[model samples]
Target: MPLRLPPLPALRFFEAAGRHQSFKLAAAELNVTPSAISHGIVGLEEALGVELFVREPRGISLTATGADYLSYVSEAFSLIAIGTQRLPNHRADRPIALSCAPTFASRWLLPRLAGFRARWPTVNVSVDTSHRQVGFPVDGFDFAIRMSRAPVAGTAWTRLFGERFVPVCSPAYLATLRDERGALSLQRATLIHVNAASEDWQAWLDATGADAIETSGGLRVDTIQLAFEAASMGLGVALGRKPLVDSDLASGALVEACAQTVAAGTAYWLVSAEQADSAIRRPELADFKRWLVDEAARFDADVAVADAVADTVPDGHVETNR
Candidate 1:
C-alpha cells in the first residue's frame, strides 16, 4: 500500500517554521521569502485538517497538535538523513569544510590538527579563515569556530573555552620597564594594540587597577598574532589573549608582564548550522567534534593545574620585561 502523507515541501515548511516559531527565520534558513513560508505552512495545515499554528500580528506559535506532529516529522527526517549517509556510494574521503577566524586558525587549530589527522586519516579537513560569519550548509561549511560572549543565532554550538587577557612582552622590553625596586612599571611602557581588540588594554588595566598607565599611544596591528610577534620582538607590551598565546608562553618567546589575568567576557565556541541532520551524514564530523571537545577539556585541565601551582608560590612585585 502507498504511504499516506502530506506534501513533502509543505512538511518541510512546517518543520522549519515550527522549529523557529517565526516564518521570517524559517524563510532565511530555507532561502525563501517569509510569504512563501507562510503560504506553505498554511497549505500544510489545510491538508492536515488541523490548525498547526496560531498566527499573531507579531509572530507565530505552534499549536499542541503541531508540536506533536513536528516531533514525528523531525524523527522521520533524521532517519532519512542517517540512511542517506549510510549509502555505499558515500565516499569516506569527503572533506569537512570549516570556517573560523584567522587568528584562531593560525594560533590554535593548525598546531593541534595533526592529532585529528592521526585519528581520521581518510578524512580531509579544509580551513577557511574568514572573519565573515558564514551561514552553515548554505555557505557549504561543515562547521565554524567563533569567539563570542554567547552562541551565534540559528546554530548549535559547544563552548570550547573562555578567554583571559594578560600583558605580555619580550624579556628585554620587560627589563627596560623595571624600576630600581625591580618592579615593572607601565607608566612609560609602549602599549601594543590590536585594531580588532581596541578595548583590551583598557579592560586589562581596569581589572588590574592600573588606571595610571598611559594607553594613548602605541603601535597598532591588525591581528592578535601580529601583536604577539611585536611583543616577542621587544617592540612593546601587548595584551595577549589566552589559548592563542599559550604556545608563545610555553616556548618562552613571550612572558607575562604581570601575574594578573582579566577575563575577556567572551569565549570561543564550535558552531554548526541548525538543521535536523547536523553531522549525521558525516561520521568524520562527529569524530572531529569529539576530538575538539576532548582537546579543550585537556587545555582547561592544564590551566587549572598551573593555576594551582601558582597559588602556592609567593606573590612577587617583579614582572617579566622580556
Candidate 2:
C-alpha cells in the first residue's frame, strides 16, 4: 500500500518547536540550527496548507492547528520510544547462555548468583551443565565457565580463581575425630570419591602423608558437588574446593576433616570467543562479563581473608592439630 504522510523531519521539527513554544529551544534540543528548524516548520506548514506556528517579534507560539497536530505527533514519538525500550528486554529474556560444569555451577556459581542478579537486574543468565567444553560461537553459547588447565583454542579466557583441595566432612563426622591423638586418621572412615575429581583427593592424601589410605575404596559419585553433599550428610569425607565450601564451613554445616590443602592445578575461567560476532546483538553479555569479573575479584579477596585467618590460628585451635 502506498502511504502518504508529511516528511518525518518536518514533523519532528514542528513537534519539538510546538512543545518548546520556540524554534530556538527546539533547535537546541534537536542539535540543529534554529534556521533549520524554522525552514522545516515552514515546509511542513506549506504541505499542510495551514500555519502551525505564528512567529512573533518576541519568539513563536503554536496556532490552534499546530497545537492539535502536536498532541498526535508527541504521542507517536512517545510510543516509538517506549517500544524501543522493550526490545532489548525481549532479547535479554533469551539470557546470556553459558555452558559450565554441573559441580562448579552448583557449588560456586549458583550460591553467589543472587548478587549478580541484584547488580544486573535486566541481564538474564542460564547455565548449561556439561563436563565437556562446548565449542564457542559454534555452540551458540554467549559464555562458558570452565575449570581448565589451559584456555580452549579460538576463545579468550579470563582466570577467575584457582582451587585449593582440602578434605571436608559433616560436623557430626568431625565430632567423631575430636578425641583422636596426634594426626587425625581417616583409615576407618568411608571416603567419598568423585570420578571427575579423583586427582584432588589423591593430592590431599599425598600432602598429608596419608599414603596408606585407599582413596579408590569408597562410594563413587559422578560430580564433585554431589560428593560434598554426601560428606555434608555425614556419609564420608569428601575432597572439597575451598571456595565451594566457604559458606558450608562458615555455617557450621561442614568442617575441615584435615588441615592439609593442595593446589588443584586447574582453575575456574570465564571464556568466550575473541570476536563477539555471534551474539553481539545481545548487549547483556557485556554486562554479565563485567559483573562476573567483579564478582571473581571479590571472591578472591574473601578467600585471601580466609587464608589469613587459617594462618593466624592460635596454638590450641583445631587447625593446629593438623
Best by lDDT: 1
For candidate 1, lDDT tens digit of each residue in 1-322?
9989899998888877777788887888788999999999888878889999998888889899989998788667656655555677866466888899888898888989999999878789999885554644545577889888898666799998888798899988889888887777777588999998798888888887777777879899998889999999999999989878888999999998887878788888999867636456566788898999899889888877877797688766744322
Worst 10 residues of 1 by lDDT: 130-139
Writing each residue's lDDT as its tens digit, candidate 2 over 108-223 gives: 78887898889888767888884443543434477888888988765799999888888889988876755456445667668888886677767777775777777768888887
Best by TM-score: 1
lDDT of each: 0.81, 0.77
Q: Give the TM-score of each candidate.
A: 0.69, 0.64
- The segments of candidate 1 whose C-alpha lies over 4 angstroms from its true place after superposition are 1-92, 276-278, 318-322
Model 1 pairs in collision = 170-322, 171-322, 174-321, 175-321
